[model samples]
Target: WDEEPFELIVSNPPYSVKWVGDGDATLINDPRFAPAGVLAPKSKADMAFIMHSLSWLAANGTAAIVCFPGIMYRGGAEQKIRKYLVDNNYVDAVIQLSGGLFFGTSIATCIMVLKKGKSDNKVMFIDASKECIKVTNNNKLTPENIDRIVDVFAKREEVAHFSHLADYAEIAENDFNLSVSTYVEPEDTREKIDIKKLNAEIAEIVAREQVLRSEIDKIIAEIEG
Candidate 1:
């Protein structure tokens, strides 16, 4: 608490405050967030924490904040604040995280990485929800998992169904929705079934049924005659 402001700031803050935001007369005009009298509900303070970090960030520095999924693409004050951030070209990356990764909660979370004076105009959305491996009781990001993500972040590669470098215009077109699934889709895996084998099995069943029917008919005729 005695040190001066640093070049970079990063933190994971609580999602809610258990308090009301509308009652706070000073929060509406806060220069850190949206200027449209928009402030996050005090109960859901994830955006508030993000805005605070953004305000404290240096001109050339970055802030990485972990937040709930709602803060990324919600309406009202959230959308306004998100608009302010994205419109200012401050958002760098939005990473979707796997569910069941954190203890005491199963709600899927997302990481919002904000950079002032970022090199790229487009924002990178990475869907790393599938990058986790199941541990004893929760999903965990392994060395490989973390490495793959870091590698992607460094290179900003557009790997199909994993990551996408979305243009700022495209993001605006989507009404500022920052959900990772909106940009990066998980890889689809499906095996083609063998219709030939299924047809053969059906034919064999029909043949067996006809043979049993013939045998039954002959036995009934013999008994009657």
Candidate 2:
């Protein structure tokens, strides 16, 4: 197939695959991967498809791709590819989806939105990991959930625990790790503990135990006498 840029691209590329193996290293020189300056590991072709799609992305086009979570944070060549994408300001946003949203597996997937002609150098991250309803054996994303995500994405606003807009400098400070959790904080759900009250209760219990022990000793002594 020829590398021709398109106005739009959408794909749910295979999460991971061993593309080059057994000392076959021909892909390292592929023009599509030239911008990344490195080839994705043989065991993981996630970046391969990303770079391929990006190579053919039109200047005014956008590509929405479903990706394995690992590609956002894994080290080595994948990290380098992410650096290229981030440094060049090609990545528009990364949306984290709820786990179990897909059939046959419960792995949480993420969507990476790429644009060749971006107006800004920031990347928006949406933590939609909880935006789903459990239906029987898997989770389902309702229209409301999708709308909420799209709203934040379109606005590019920062919502507490739900979304964040991180600039290139911030991403660089983070070593180009595009994991949503790294940028958008999750809501804390665990019950908050009052340490002072708990300590007072423990002290009261100890005092009551001592008093009961003393009373029991006196009763035993009286019985013996």
The candidate maximizing lDDT is: 2
Clashing pairs in 1: none
CA shift at 87, candidate 1, in angstroms?
2.0
RMSD of 2: 2.2
Model 2: per-residue lDDT, tens digit, 78-129? Answer: 9999999998889999999988987777899999999989999999999999
lDDT of each: 0.84, 0.91
Model 2 residue 121 lDDT score: 91
Clashes of each: 0, 0
For model 1, give the RMSD to the true fold.
2.9
Off by over 4 Å in 2: 1-4, 21-26
lDDT against true structure, model 2: 0.91
Candidate 1 lDDT, 166-213, residue by residue in tens: 998999999999989888876768887799999999999999999999
Candidate 2 clashes between residue pairs 3 or more apart in a chain or in different chains: none
- Candidate 1 lDDT trough over 10 residues, lowest sum: 1-10
- Residue 74, candidate 1: alpha-carbon lDDT: 80
Q: Alpha-carbon error at 171 in model 2, in Å? A: 1.5
